[model samples]
Target: MGRAFVYVILGGGVAAGYAALEFTRKGVSPGELCIISEEPVAPYERPALSKGFLLPESPARLPSFHTCVGANEERLTPKWYKEHGIELVLGTRVKSVDVRRKKLLTATGETISYKILLIATGARALKLEEFGVDGSEAENVCYLRDLADANGLVNVMQSCSSGNAVVIGGGYIGMECAASLAINKINVTLVFPEVHCMARLFTPKIASYYEEYYQSKGVKFVKGTVLTSFEFDSSGKVMAVNLRDGSQLPADLVVVGIGIRPNTSLFEGQLTLEKGGIKVNGKMQTSNDSVYAVGDVAAFPVKLFGETRRLEHVDSARKSAKHAVAAIMEPKKSGEFDYLPFFYSRVFGLSWQFYGDNVGEAVHFGDYSSGTFGAYWISKGHLVGSFLEGGTKEEYEAIAKATSLKPPVEDLAELGQQGLNFALTISKKPQPALPIEVSRSTSGLVLEKPVYAWHAAAGLVLTASIAGFAYWYGRRRRRW
Candidate 1:
C-alpha cells in the first residue's frame, strides 16, 4: 500500500516553498499535504546562492533568507511546516511518476500516491560536457544550482592557493560568481561566446558600461569566444581552459555558468510540452487534470506577451505557485494567471532591473557615462519594456507600472530624452495618445475611490467597512 496525500509538491525549490506557504494560508487539513524533495532542506531563497552565500564575510545561511521572507512574509522553516502538519519527505528522490496511477515511485522503492501533484522540479545547470568538453567532470569545476554547489564553491575558494578562476558563460551565474570570486581575492577571467556580458538583456553600450566597471575591479572579460576544452593535471583537476579563440587561461578553479535546461524529461511523453517545458493552462494545470506544473518546468501563458513561456526566475516561480494553489483551493473565484516578466541582477555594487519584452529599438536614456541610466524598448510603437540601474524605489515602481500599461511611444527620440520622467508621468494617469491602452477591467485606478473587494465587489458601499476591505484586499495581493 502506498502513502497518500491530497497535495504533493515535487521538487524543493522556490515554487514548492511558496506553494506550501500558500496552502497553509489558504487553509489546509493536517496530513493532507506533503512535499518531497531531493534536497535535505525545504525551499530556500535560490538567488542567494550566487549572492549572499558567496560573500567572503558572514554569508547568509539557512532559516534567515528562506522563502516568504523574500516576499516580506513569514519564513517557512522546518518547524513551521511541522506545526502546520505538512509532512516533508526530504533528501528523497522520486525515480519515476505514473500520472495514470497518480503515484510517485521513490528510488528507495517507496510509493507515494497523491490526489493532486504540483511539479516544481525547476531546472538543472547546463554542463560543459554537453558542449563537447570534459572539464565539467574535472575537480575544481563547480556549477551553482543548489545549496550543495554553493557550499562546495565556498570550500574550494577557501582552500585554493593560486587564487585564480576561469568562469564559463557570461550570463547571470557567470557575472555573479565572478564578482564573488574577485571579492575573495581570486583573479577571474570570464569567457563567453556573446559579444558582451548579459548579451540577452544589455545592449553593447550598456554592457560596455558594466564591463568597464568590472575591468576596474580587476575582472577580465574574454568575449566573442568560448571554451574549447580544459587542461587537466595528473590529479584530475582543471588547470587551464582552452578557448576557441586559440588562447589558453591557467585556472586554479573553474565555474561553469553556461545556462540551464528545464527538468522536464520525467514528464516528457507523459505530459504535453511547449516552449521547452510542460505545457500548462492559465490555471497551471497540465493535460492530466490532477497534475499541475509550476516554476521553470512549466510553460505557462505569459499574459503580457500573449504567449507561453517557461520563465526561469524566482518571481515567476513564487507567483505561479501561489496562483496554482489558489486555483485548486477556490476554483470558482480563481481566474487566469496574469503576469508580467521581471528579471534583475546585482553584481559588484551595481544593480539593474528589467520589465517586459526586450524587443524593437532600444532608446538609451539618462547619462550612460555613469551613475543612474537605463533604456526603453519601443516595440510596435508601444513602450513594451523598461530597464534601469541605480534607480530609486519610486523610479523602479514607475517603470514597472508604466511598462505594464504598454504605453505608446510616438517619438522615440523624445521618449529617450524624457526617459524616467515619461514613465513616471504615464504611470500616474491614462495617456491615451501615448500608447496607454489598458482594459477598463484591470486598471488599479478603478478601485482607488471604492472601498469594497475590487475583483468581486459590485456597486459602491457607503463606509469605512468597505474601504478597509478594499484596502486590505488590494494591498495583500497587489502584485498577484
Candidate 2:
C-alpha cells in the first residue's frame, strides 16, 4: 500500500521551493501536492550559503533566507507548506522513479505515485578526489553547496581564524569563499588554472579590477596552475597545498570550489539528455509528457537567444521552476518561457550585474580606479550585453532595457565615451511594455516604475547616438 499525490516535486532546493509556492498560488488542493527532498529543511535561497551565510559576524542562518525571499517575495518556510496542506517529505530520498507507472520508490521502501512530476535535483560539488587528489576527507577542507556544507565551513572558519587558507578553483565559490576568509582575518591564497579570475565571464580588464581589490585585502593569487597534492598533518588536517608550479603554500584550511555536475544520473535512461542536463521544451516539459524538469538540471529553450541552455544561476532556477509550474497548471494560458541570461555577485563592498550574452567586441566605460565601471558587448553592430559595477537601481534597469532591445551601434568609440549615458538615454525613450505575465518571467526588466512607450520621432532626434559614434572614433583602444 502506498500514498499518491497529484503533483510530486523532486529535490528540495531553490527550484523546489519556488515550484511549491507557484503551486499554492495556482490553487493546488489540500493533499494533492507533495515535495520530496533529501534536505531536512524547506528550500532556502542557495546563493546565501556562499554570501551572507559566510559573514564573519552576524552570519545569516536558515529561516532568514528561505525561497522567494531572494526575489523580495514571501518567504516560504516549512510552516507555509503545512498551512497550505502541501506535504513536506523532508529528509527522504527517492531511490527510483518509474515514469511509465508514474511511481517513485523511496529509500524507505514506500511507493509514492504522482500524476505529474517535476524534476529539480539541482547539482553536487565536484570533489578534489575526482581530480586525482585525495585528502578531502580531512576535517579542515570544505565545499559550500548546501546548508550542512555552510555550517561545516563556518565551524572550520571559526577554528582557523588568523591562519592561512588555500582556496582551489577561481570560479564563484572560490572567489566568494576567499573574500569571506579574508574578512574573518584569515590569510587566503586563491589558486586556479586560468590567467585571471572569473575567466569565463569577466574580460581580462574587468578581472584586473577585482584582482587588484582582492590584493589590497592581502589575498594572494596563483594563476595558470592547478593543485597537485595536499599535505596533511598527523591528525588528517590539511597542512599545505602543492601546486604544479613547484610552489608549496602552508595551509591551516582548504576550500575546494572546482565545479558541479547536475544530478541527472537517475533519469539517464528514462529521459532524453542534452548539454549534460535533461532536455526540456520551452514549457520546461521533459520528453515524457508527465514529467518536467527545472533548475540546473533542465536544459530548456531560451527564447531570447533562440537556443537551449542549461543555466546554473539562482535566477534561472527560480524563474524556470515558476515557469514549469505555470505551464503545468495553466496550460492554455501559459506561454513559452522567454528568459534573458542574468548573473550577479556581491563580495567585499563590490557588486556587479550582467545581462544578456557576452559575445562580440566588448567596449568598457567608467572609471575603473574609482570602483565604478561597466562594459557593453556589441555583436554585428548591435548592443547585445551590458555589465555594470556599483550601479544604482535605476542604472541596472536601464542596462537591462537596453540589452533587451539590442539597439544598433554605429561606432564603437562613441559607445565607450557615452558609456552609461547610452543606456540612460535608451531608458528614457518611449518603448512598448512587455505583457504583464511575460515581463515577470524575464530577468532584469520588471520594475516598479512604469515603462515608457516608444516615441519614434523623439528617438531619432536623440544626440547621444551621434556623439557616441564620434567618441568611439577618437578614443578607440585595443580590446582586452
Find the candidate with the highest lDDT and give its number.
2
Structural similarity to truth (TM-score) of each candidate:
0.89, 0.90
lDDT of 1 by residue, 295-347 (tens): 99999987666667888899999999999999988889899998888999898
Q: What is the C-alpha lDDT of each candidate?
A: 0.88, 0.91
Query: Number of clashing pairs, model 1?
Result: 3
lDDT of 2 by residue, 1-480 (tens): 689999999999999999999998998999999999999999899999989998978989879999989999999998899899999999998899999899999999999999999999999999988989998878899999999999999999999889999999999999999999999999999999999999988999999999999999999999999999988888888899999999999999899999999999889899999999999998999999999999999998875565688998999999999999999999999998878889999999999999988988999999987888999998767787899999999999999988887777999999999999999998789865643222322342232233344544456657678888877876766342
Q: Clashes in model 1: which pairs? A: 408-434, 408-435, 451-466
> What's model 2's lDDT at 81?
91
The reply for model 1, stretches above 4 Å from the true place, is 430-480
Which portions of model 2 show Cα errors greater than 4 Å? 432-480
